[model samples]
Target: MSLTEILSNFHISETTEEIYKNTIKASEIETPIGKLIAVADDNFLYILIKLKSPDKVINTFNILQKELSSSIVIGSTKIITQLENELTEYFSGKLKSFTIPMRCLGTDFRQQSWNQLKKIAYGETMSYGELAVKLGRNVNHARAVGSAAGANPIIILVPCHRLTAQNGHLGGFSCGIDVKTWLLQHESKFKNK
Candidate 1:
């Protein structure tokens, strides 16, 4: 379906901001699994995942959407809705990995790095050196690979937090190290589950 149709179905509104033109939409629904809040941006969708109760998670997609311009288009699928559910659960100390399909715009190498990041299992971490090796590059190329990973616009969906320094030190994150820590901790909590 078209982005407008999807947004309309969910009762979402489109608007423009100083930085970008974007669309924001969300829905609260009762499901067999539980209650869920689904949020979508122009390029990505997020689900508010919960652990014990859905009350804890706030629907931030609209806030983000309102901040952007309306020129952006939202992708179609239930994936963003599911992701919102899973992310809600994750932040509340419940979920680990997400199953959402994400579309990232980037160059060939950046795309490769982002794809490699998805290979990182939940609760597992890999150093930039390791990622570079996986790409068949010298260890010194780790920095470049990390740069590519940092440029990943999809963040959690691509699992960039899974990449670290060789000594296991937390490195730079485009979204900030605190977010990276949260993602790591959240994933670690679900390691065995």
Candidate 2:
């Protein structure tokens, strides 16, 4: 049977063979800003993408379906639930840092950049050059660091929104510049309270 057929059973087998199967559970949750589609596996939360309209959520799911060889089932796990709660608190301005478990998928260099991205405190912003220097990379490595930041898949949970241009201009965000501006403004408004 196909992986999709297996996932349609709605119960994941814990056997060794089943464990080797890359079964991804996905679900969509609404937020104040918009709807976010979360895709995760049994042990780790994978990618979370934001959309301005509910209609576009499926487009992302379709893309993931093609990109990942795993079974992209429409379901949620305990970890996904927890992350959703954390997102709720964050968007509501009650949480600063996320406490949920996440296993980031990226290269060592990109991972280093993402780790530094998380270190940026809430209500604060840093430039790409500053982030690169903090990671012990040369100042000119800022552009490369920016590339890694753009590649980050976890989005708001990792606080990629905290990164700005050296002159403090809002930088690029995969979710769009408006969303970036909103996230920065949202954090700044509640970070001091």
The top-ranked prediction according to lDDT is 2
Q: TM-score of the candidate numbered 1?
A: 0.61
Q: Cα lDDT of all candidates, in order?
A: 0.61, 0.75
Tens-place lDDT per residue, model 2, 1-193, is 2223433543334563353456678777787666676878757777776744333344444444445545577788887889888888888899998887776767899889888888999989999999999999888998998899877768887878888889878878877888888888898899898
Would you give me the overall lDDT of model 2? 0.75
- Per-residue lDDT of model 1, residues 1-38, tens digit only: 32234444434333333445344455454433344344
Clashes counted in candidate 1 amount to 20
Question: What residue runs in model 1 are displaced by over 4 Å at the alpha carbon?
Answer: 1-70, 73-79
Model 2 spans with C-alpha error above 4 angstroms: 1-20, 52-69
Worst 10 residues of 2 by lDDT: 1-10
lDDT of 1 at 155: 54
